[model samples]
Target: MRKILATHPLHPRATAMLAGAGRLAVASALDPKTLTTEARDADIVIVRAPLPPELFQGAANLRAAIRHGAGLDMIPVEAATAAGVLVANVPAVNARSVAEHVMFAALALLRRFRVMDRDLRAKGWLAGREHANSTSELAGKTIGIVGLGAVGQAVGHIAAHGFDLNVVATTRSLRPAPERVGFLSIDALVEQSDVIVLCCPLTAETRGLISRERIARMKPGALLINVSRGPVVDDEALIEALREGRIGGAALDVFSVQPLPPNHPYFGFDNVIVTPHMAGITEESMMRMGVGAAGEALLVLAGKLPVNLRNPEVIEHYRRRFPAGD
Candidate 1:
């Protein structure tokens, strides 16, 4: 039987989908050391957790590494391609979940829900009601989105239709222009928008995309939300901005560092909302992603290419290793 290893367990429904293909193995935890050992003899790796690039060094039996989610930053594509292994990811499966998360953060910050609840518990009901006059509504605010892909599109739909908010978006694709959202350059969008949401992928050109200079361009008191990768925004610059009160407030779902150190400055800020990179997780999205990953794994094992293949150049060596009809 082929060795099928999962960095973490997939949904039972997805396991059933792959039951007929091969034997399944799982890591004890989602840590680096555990994943490296579990991935040792895997013919196929279902990546639910971030893995080390060194895992592919002597992986002669590895046929494919499939990401359970859209982001490939968690999986090192360069090392996999160099090892002649196929890399694939399931995209757009968690768009709705992340988009809803952005909306939740926006409203929570605008309405000062955390502060109000804290005062009511610590002091009295009157102290909480005293701050009710400061709350703002979502309607009529201009929302700027970075990267108008699946998640951005979903956010635009809700901002425009459900909340009656004005929507503006920046994208790499410009000719056709994404529908239902006005197109603008990043600088212009930041200047005009009341809120900015980042859903862009992290890349060489995009790392530290939001620097001090860019942060200075933002409309005063404009809220910022990031559901994208952490390195895209300069953490130090953002912290400085938040501390100086140059930027109004921020809701961060992803960070440059994981677990964000217990005494991190972000933890002390009332204007900032931090989450443990779970914006893309929901019951429905988990089901869709698990099912999608299983289907791609089965395809690769059957000597066929995955529909969401990230590295096509690996095919030349891959076919030579495991021919179509072996």
Candidate 2:
């Protein structure tokens, strides 16, 4: 039987499926060193945590690294490709979940949900009711989406149709804009949007895309919602902006650091909403991601290439490593 390793436990359905394909093991810890050691003998790895590039060196038996979700940031694809290990991901499976999260965060920030909830329990109903005067409505507001991917498109649909809000987007694609959605330059979007939602993937060009300069251009009291990877925004610059009350508020789901330290300054601000990188994790999405990852593992073990292969260049090398009908 082939050996399989998962960085984290999967849904019971997925776990059972993988178990039928190979001798599956879940990592006890997620640190690079621990993952590298545990994956040394793994024939396939279901990746949830970040895998170090060095892991491809020691894991000679590794046939593929399958991401549990759409993001490729956690898996070192270049190293895996160089080492003849296939890289695959379950793309856009959680787009609805993440898009819903963007809307949730926007509404929460606009309505001061966090502060109102806290004070209502502590003070009284009147205390919470008084904040309603400051709260804003979602309708008629312009939502600027960064990156017009599946998640971004979903957010735009909801913003335009569901909430009767105007939608604008910035994307690298040359395709025509969706009906009722206006495409704009990033600078124009920042200046014009009442709320800015980041759904872009982290890339060379996207790293630090939201800088202090761009934050400064935002209209006063503009809401920022980030469901993308953390490094896409300059953390210090955002903090500085938030400190000066330059922007209205922000809802951050991903941070540069995992398990943000207890005293992280983000926790100090009532205007800032911080989540533990769970914007894409709902019960339904988790099952879909888990099952998709398990299916990819099974495909590779059966001598078939994954449907969503991220590193297609590795196919020739991978085929040589595990010859057909071996």
Candidate 3:
């Protein structure tokens, strides 16, 4: 019987799927050393954290590592391949969930939802003038997206059709964008946009890509949204901009530090909205991710290419190690 170990927390359905296939080892979380040991006895390992090559070195039977979501930054793909483990990630499965979260954040910030929630609880009246003075209509605003990938494209669709907002993007490559969407230089996008949304991946080239000067160039009163990795935006520089009112507001779903410190200044800022990294979580997203991971695991075990293999080259090395004839 093939053994499968699930280290990260996933939907109950994922556990059921694995159980239906073979022996399933489930854990809410796994220590790095314990996980390494477990992999040796397992045919597949699924997780959401970094899987160093050393962890798989002893896993003679390990065929695949399934990711619960996109963003392979946490895992070492090249290392996994050398160890003959196929690595796969589920992309676009959670795109709609994250895009909706962005819309909620944008609308919440523009309408001052946080402040109103606090005030109403304390005093109990919607002081008309104060609210009206702070709120802004989103219809005519220009929104610049830093990445034109799945989530970015989804956001563009909503903004153009639902809100009639002008959309622009600055992608790694200059590809033809949809109608009413234009490509701009990163600096130009920052300076011209009324709202700046980050949806890119975190790579060496993109680390601190949104530098202090880029933040400084943004249109005054512009709103900033980052659903992407936190380090992409210089956290310290962003704080400074917020302190000086150089930018209007920020809606952050991810932070450089997870579970932001209790005394973090971001919590005290009236113009900033913060949420735990939950932009990609939803009931529907959970189901898709669960099914996707299960399907990939089964494919890898059968010596077939997983549908979403991030490193296709790994197949050559994998076949050499586990010749489970296709």
Candidate 4:
């Protein structure tokens, strides 16, 4: 039986499906060294965590690296292609889940949910009631979305249709703007928005896209919501802004460091809402991602390319490595 390695546990349904197709092994630990050792003999790898490029060096039997979700950042595509490995991913499977999370974070920050809940438990009902004075509603607010990808589009839909808010966006795509959504330059979007949402992918152009200078451009008391990769925003710049109360508040799901260091400065700010990179995780989305990843694995095992193949240029090398009719 061919060996399959999963960086983390999949939904039970996906687990059973892969088990029937190959010898499935879930990683015990996520460190680079541990994953490298565990994946050396794997024919297929379902990636959830970052896969070091060096893992491809000695993985002779590896034919594919399948991402459990949309982001390709976790898998080094260049390294995989160089090693004759196919890279595939389940894209947009969790767009709704992440969009919902963005709304949740926005509501939590605008309503002062965390502080109110804390004070209610520690002090009394009246203390919690006092927080209502500072709360704001979503109606009639102008929301600016960075990147009009699946997640961004979903967020715009909810903001415009569900909350009766105005939606504007910036995107690298050449496509026409969606109805009720106006396209704007990044600078304009940042300046005019009441709520700025970052849904762009992490790339050379986007690294530090929301810099200290841009933070200065934001309207005073404007809210920031980042569901994108961590490094897109300057952590120190944001903290400085929050300290001076330059902006209203922020909701951050991804961070520059995983498990954000204990006693991190962000935790000290009541206006900042921090989450453990779980914006795309929901029971429904998990199953969809898992099943999608597993289906790709099974296709590769059957000597076929995945439907969502991310690296088509690697096909010649892959075919040579695993010749057909063998």
Q: What would the per-residue lDDT of candidate 2 be over residues 13-132, giving only the tens digit for each residue?
A: 898887778798999899999999999999999999999999999998999999999999999889999999999999888999998998899899989999999899999999988889
- lDDT at 149 for candidate 2? 90
- Candidate 1 per-residue lDDT over residues 1-326, each given as its tens digit: 88889877888889999999999888788777777777778889999778799888867789999999998988899899888899999999999999999999999999988888889999999999977898899899999999988999999999999999999999887656555689998889988999999999998878998888898888878999999889989888888888888877999998888878889998998888989999999989989999999999999988899999999999998888888865
Where model 1 places Cα greater than 4 Å from the true spot, the runs are: none
Task: Give the TM-score of each candidate.
Answer: 0.97, 0.98, 0.94, 0.99
Number of clashing pairs per prediction, in order: 0, 0, 0, 0
Please give the lDDT score at residue 269 for candidate 1: 87
Q: Is candidate 3 or candidate 4 better by TM-score?
A: 4
Clashing pairs in 4: none
Clashing residue pairs in candidate 2, if any? none
Q: For candidate 3, give the lDDT of residue 235.
A: 89
lDDT over C-alpha atoms for residue 237 of model 3: 92
lDDT, residue 296, model 2:
93
lDDT of 1: 0.90
Whose TM-score is higher: candidate 2's or candidate 3's?
Answer: 2
Q: What lDDT would candidate 4 get against the real structure?
A: 0.94
